[model samples]
Target: MLEREELKLYNRQIILPELGLAGQEKLKVARVLMIGAGGLGCPVLQYLVAAGVGHVGIVDADVIDISNLHRQILYSIADVGKPKAETAKQKLEWLNPFVELTAYEERLNTENAARLINLYDLIIDGSDNFTTRYLVNDTCVALNKPLVFGSIFKFEGQVSVFNYQDGPNYRDVFPEPPPENEVPNCDETGVIGVLPGIIGTYMANEAIKIICDIGETLSGKLFSMNALDNSMNVYKITKQRQAISAPVAANLAASPDREISMETLSNWLGETPDEICIIDVRETYEFDDYNIGGLNIPLYELQESVDIIPVDKKLVFICQTGQRSKIALQWTESHLKNEKYSLKNGIKHNL
Candidate 1:
């Protein structure tokens, strides 16, 4: 049902034998939801809109920072401090006025994950952290939706399609999230500027193929690429239906009961500094560079040094973001009888 103007606009793609008018129509009617508007999201959003995805929804609560300009190509210096989803929507609409775009300027949490995901036919994850990635994958599995997943670290990138046609998913590959300290994100370990572009384009290609029914999708395999060495590998992954373990259940629960906001922590520290004990669970280097006055106890050493933490004071655990702190909170809750809390969203949000 393409109008005259729409046909002319997509003439180049319409000419392809594998994707003629019918395929173009399929693209026109497809609904896509992108989880992040960061490094990987920039290219995926650009190509999807240019390819004529009829309806695109962007979900990201982050604002643009000067440091993001290198990999996140959609924004300019002027866009710093602006909400990513809204800025991306403005730019995408200009790229293809034929497509409709919706911007959700909020983070995707457990409470709203299901509802937001249900609104779209496909979910493309461009998230950087394990927490959101796991949440997205689990939600996709629960809703029986296809998820195009991509991640970048240093010069390496990985892409895959999960929960498509009963295929293996993120959990099927990793089973459980890695120890937060074991895996460093792009913020801690820098990525090559073009790595996300390469992987994100592949993700966009998978989405296009899925929508047009053109070729085989990466449903049961993981695609890994190294930009530095130009090495590529595809690994076969199998789904494991084992019952969720206690740790995995704790992660899934994502309870708010143990979380303390930055504002609340600041106020408490100001009024009764002696009553609070902040244990920074980040790596030593991270703590040495910048810290908000806390005892540095790297997550890997927490078990050996658990006894050092004071049980009398209101214990608050913090890490770079919040994933490690959550894990630390779980460990402390199981072993110690102290009043424990995790800084909500970690120190990153506060800074």
Candidate 2:
């Protein structure tokens, strides 16, 4: 039973026609785990806490930075340098004192993902990369849990619910992981601050519908939104293959040392001269905004222009964030298997 103060605290939500007392009660008992405390996580966390989600777990290993203030609205300039997850937990606790907020000030990786996710009823993914995105998807599928998904790029965003009651999962739509470096992150490519907010709210809405058992769930549909046009499109998908292959499983299991932290990358940048061959995979406009000194090659143009890359030099791939760089590196590796190449680390981290 909820205390009188608790009841008073959630009165506005309880009075809603769509979300009545029962809906509020459901939220009170529910446990949710959200990955990432960046742009999308900020809004999702705020509304979920405000709506009285009984227990919420936030996992993020990042510290607040001034650059994050544009979209990660939860943090203030004063909060910069503080651990994002802990700061969010403190703010959430104040928003709904009746709710319990858990903060894991650590990155969500393959080793800890299963254990961390096992404690929750549902998982919300605001993670920025294909690696973490696929990690969460596979883990959620293995546990047979519902996942609220969101991703933003440039002026667009995508939202969906995966692994919900035998619905078409993410794998159904994107059967194979594209060779790394194909997709750039918000930081690498630059996202309008408001974009993640729109996507994050959609993720929160999906969570609410799943919690309350009302409205049409975006189970088999991918919702794409273009901020520039104020347009929304939903593409339905069907299950093509079930049971990921052993090779795919092995790939997931493989811990490649290709990844580096933004801090490590920054350090390397400071120590090394610009003589190394660095390929920046972000769009041209992004090159104009802010970028490390590197050769610009948009992701889509890489395949046709592979000939331009010099064979003798040690190639280092970079992008807005590391996502596209990883893809580009993978593509470069397969095409030039005998060539020597590597990837630069995080674009947003330490920046």
Candidate 3:
């Protein structure tokens, strides 16, 4: 039951024939957990809050940096170095005081993923890495929850609905994580500031439609759009039963062994500067703005520059958020006989 003030606040959306007062109430009862509060999460959080989604939870361990300002409009220069989930909760409360907002200021790892995801009615994957993406997808499959997935790189973005009423999931479409170098994220390729806004709104739209039972949801369909040309395409996705087997779920939940925590890296940089070789695999522009001092070898150029990398020292690869560094580590391990490691959670945690 909406209060008198609540009805007035959402009058515009409530008047729609498809979304009457009942639909508004459905939104008020829906529980959504948004994963990541970065580029894509910004607009999804904004629109859902405005629409009065009753209980919305934000999960992101990262703090804001100046580079995120151009796309993550929910934040400002004042928010730099602050936890994203907490900051989003504060601002979103101001947007819709009637709504309930929860912020989880920790990374969504295997141990906590199921516990956190089970609390929500739907999961929104705004995450940037393949590891987290696959992990979230498998968790949703195991728990039988719907997932609204979105990804953006450069001028293009993709949006889809997965595992809704036994629909195709993320793994059904891709099956395996792409070779990291094959798909460079917004951090590496550089997205036009408005791309996420366009994509994220679509993701929010899917969530609302699913909750209200209005309009055709993108279940088993992948929507791809290019902001440059404003061209869009929708492709039908088929489910592969083997994609969500027990062995696959176990593999997805397993953590890698080559990751070094932020604290350990800091200690090494201080105590063994000569024994450690830090390599920044991010793009040149990212290194120029802010870096912890390392050889700038973008992931694309890593194969050609293998000769310059030292094989004797403990080689540590670093990137904006660690995905590229993991890829760089794989390449270095194959090419050079060195002790390889990747900075866990990436440099974003340090910033």
Candidate 4:
């Protein structure tokens, strides 16, 4: 039941023939727990609160960083250094007093995953890492809760509904988490600030649809969009005979000295450009699509002392994941004795 004030606050949306009063009421009582109060979480919380979602929970251990101002619209310079979950709740409470907000200022980890997940009627995975993504999906499957998932890479974003009414869970679409460094994150690759807003709102819309039991949700569909090209796609998701739980890839567990961190590599590139050579082993198409300034030498075509190996420049092999780059190094091991390494976790990061 909505208060007289809530009815007025949401009158515009309430009047929609498809939504009406019944839908508004459903929103006023829906309990939603969103993971990650970063880029994606900001817009989602704002829309859900303003739209009168009655009970909302936020879980984020990260404090506001100055870099977050671009996409985390709910925060400002003044809010920097504050806990995201708490700051969001305090501000969102003012957005709609009719909605109850709770903040858990902590990361969602294995120990606390099940407990926190069980508290909500639905889950919106605003998390940015592959580990958390799979953990959230598995827990949702265990607890029988619907999960609305969204992720943003450099210029593209993906959204889908998992474990909805026994629909294909996340595992069915991505049965395994990509290697830790296979896909670089926004921090490493960068995203246009407005991209998250566009994608996050789509996620919130999915949540509203679920809570109100209206419209066809992306229960068994994957929605992907490229902000750079302004293209969108919706692909049907097929469930596997049994959901396969994927282990977090240990592709980065190689010897410490044998691998390089992106930060160190970036610092080296900036300070001593002549000292480092980043050899991207991904295919020509992949490297052409995106690369962080590196030579494009397809792994399949790699050869010893390939095209006069520079003796002065330290070699760093890179690929989608660190695994293929390792192969590239082995192929060149005998002929090239220059200090070489496989980029720790590859060029792009999933998280």
| lDDT-superior candidate, 2 or 3 | 3
- Candidate 4: which pairs clash? 183-348, 183-349, 183-350, 184-348, 184-349
TM-score of each: 0.70, 0.69, 0.70, 0.69
**Cα lDDT tens digits for candidate 2, 1-351:** 677987888888788888888888888899999999999999999998887889999999999999999999999999999999999999888788888999999988655776788789999999987878877886676556799999899889999999887787776787445657686665678989998899999999999999987789999999999999999999997865343211212122213566655555556667764535678876677777777777888754677677887766556777654555655565565555433333444354436
Evaluate residue 11 in candidate 3 and report its C-alpha lDDT on the 0 to 100 scale.
Answer: 95
User: Which structure is stronger by TM-score: 3 or 4?
Assistant: 3
In the range 1-351, model 3's lDDT, one tens digit per residue, is 999999999999999999999999999999999999999999999999999999999999999999999999999999999999999999999999999999999998755787788889999999999879976886776567899999998999999999998788887787547667786766667989999999999999999999999999999999999999889999999876432222213222224678898899889989999999999977677899899997998765676788998777998899876765755665455477888888887897789
**Distance from true location, Cα of 30 in model 4, Å:** 0.8
Model 2 CA deviation exceeding 4 Å by range: 243-351
Score each candidate by Cα lDDT. Answer: 0.85, 0.78, 0.86, 0.82
lDDT of 1 by residue, 78-187 (tens): 99999999999999999999999999999997657767887899999999888899778766765567999999989999999998877777877875467667989777
Model 3's lDDT to the true fold?
0.86
- The window of 10 residues in a row where model 2 has the poorest summed lDDT is 245-254
Which rank order by lDDT, best down to worst? 3, 1, 4, 2
lDDT of 2 at 212: 81
At residue 67, what lDDT does model 1 achieve? Answer: 95
Error of 1 at 299 (Å): 26
Q: Encode model 4's per-residue lDDT on 1-351: one tens digit a residue.
A: 778888899999999999999999889878999999999999999999999999999999999999999889999999999999999999999888888999999888655776788789999999989878967886776557799999998889999999988789887887557756596887788988998899999999999999988999999999999999999999999976343221222121235687788888888889999898888877677788789877887654565327755777899988876755765564456557788888877876722
